[model samples]
Target: MDNLQKCPQIVDILPTAEGQVRPMTKLEPQEQHEVWLRAVELAGGKVPTGRIVKDVVQKIMERTKVPNTYQIGEVCQILVKDNPELRGKGGCWGIVSAVNEFSCTLRMWDGEYTIGLQHLKSYNYLPAECEQMQVICDACGGLRLRINRVYSSGLEESVQKFLESLGKLNRASLTALEEKLLKVLESEIRD
Candidate 1:
């Protein structure tokens, strides 16, 4: 028996789906030598004798075509048709600050904010003409104000807070009136 048959490191040559017999593991020294001789014979003696034959795993990376929907630094126009805060604020413009697979960062006149893909309309040219010209706030005595600017700034917040406070006051007054009515009913019942 040969030393290759006695060694525990013997590798089996298996036929792959491609019909090629591939060595799957480390071989004994004698088996390695035998493989070299067989490889040289297969190569028609073109390879030098005693040279080792090794099988290396090569990875082939394929270039896939990925669809690009949007990108950072791309200027896009905002579609505010469904946004209540943006209603009547047409012609307000914005710039794309950052981009990702799902959303993009938008820098508007108010400040930098993030918006979804559905919220964007199309790529816009920089220096786009503001469609809605600045209008004087008739309520504030004709002070020039951008519509979106007014909606996003402290003016809106202050107004909302004031309304909320008024609502609480109204609720308290109603509760007090209900208690007075209950007291009057109790006094009449006693008589």
Candidate 2:
């Protein structure tokens, strides 16, 4: 690994699916070694990253344990604590329409999203509450055709907090809040 040379910058070399190619140009030999060392520590394995024959990423993924607790039609909020790209969707509720090894297909108010298991937080709600949320979820699923935009900074954060609050409401409180939320959504559609 120490003797590895920096590759050329020109289209460099395209890797074939059947062949073994290394990303020598992506990092210096020493830097590559450090990255591999870190990966080994993170994966708790002795796989060398400098070699192309080793499936380092696959091995790491195989060792990852994301519990499958999501169920179809269940209401859950999207968790986006560490995913900055998903900030706009933080705390957004969705219906789990499908479940896989490490993720779920969610039907949201704006659209459908395939979310990782770690990005889900289940909530226990009444049947009426589920019905109410389903309406919002459908609206959101269709909003992609109308609004077709991501939530902005202040709006995203506030929306997350607002939805979070809704989950904590009692039956009486939920009725009023759900009505208000539906009214707001309905109003938005008219304009």
Candidate 3:
């Protein structure tokens, strides 16, 4: 176990699918080692100087700048690797309710959050997929409001708070039974 702990962690290159491929550039072995060392230091929270880190980050940003920024109504997945506020919303999908120069206000299942561009990844979903996701979010919000109205035969803040506490149910994909239950809930809310 001690020997295992001494081994370095290996990073897989391009482990996930990306919308665009970055142009490959050749680097000497020494250059690659230096880059890896700097990355490891950053990951370990050992910043020698904020200004140096900022400059390096800016250069990297210039190289990897997105051609088009997010637009309103576009769907994006929240990347919470470095944002403590978005701790639990690591890969949750949200719709862009508002777009700013470097951030977006996303309308998620639970609520709206304004997140920086660094903490968002475009879903690159098809138009139909995006439309369906919007419908799901709208339906969920509408159903929650209806439930609040029906609870105790009046609109109640306590009921709304309780529903919000459910918080997306943390299900990556719905089970068949869950899908049926959602359909039933929607139908009940409609009536």
Candidate 4:
């Protein structure tokens, strides 16, 4: 016991490079308890229950994790915060025309632009809303294959209809005039 006072003590241990330390070594029970107590103190002195902590972690992951895949026809908004090429396109909504592993081809009002998945945010619209957006896009000459060729004055009518329906789509509600216009267009297409 007299030799203990003469022994050298570890004042501070520097962080070693990752994997240089014994990565597979397990902490002793007492050491683990000490670590847990430190963590609790760091976390506002709250003693977290296991089930509640697990649920909170899961919710955090769901809210923070970026989606790995995007589907065609999904309505998404372009995020230009970190992308220089997408300037002036922030808050602009688009439809996904093609989907790649890590990117998507978006069809916007002016033209189509290929953007990365990280720079796109889903609008989370219902299937009917998506279909309505597609129709509106088709009328705007984005998807020409599905567009009806009926031209009132060299595509002027289609352009006007596209603009009119855009407002209704955004609000998800149609005025009386818009309902009449929709009926007229539907009958015109049938005839």
lDDT of 3: 0.57
List, residue by residue over 66-91, the lDDT tens digit for candidate 4.
35577889999888743468865677
C-alpha RMSD for every candidate: 24.3, 11.7, 11.6, 16.5
Ranking by TM-score: 3, 2, 4, 1
Against the true structure, candidate 1 has what lDDT?
0.40
Candidate 3 lDDT tens digits, 29-72? 54334443444355452322433333344345446554447877
Q: Per-residue CA lDDT of candidate 1, range 21-100, in tens?
A: 22313344555456544444444543422222332110000112223376555556666533455543344345566776
Candidate 4: where is the Cα deviation over 4 Å? 1-67, 142-191
Whose lDDT is higher: candidate 1's or candidate 4's? 4
lDDT of each: 0.40, 0.54, 0.57, 0.55
Winning model by lDDT:
3
Better candidate number, 1 or 4, judged by TM-score: 4
Instruction: Give the number of the best model, judged by TM-score.
Output: 3
Candidate 4 has an lDDT of 0.55
* Model 2, span 70-153: residue lDDT tens: 778888888884446566677677788899887899876445789866568888777687777766655444333323332222
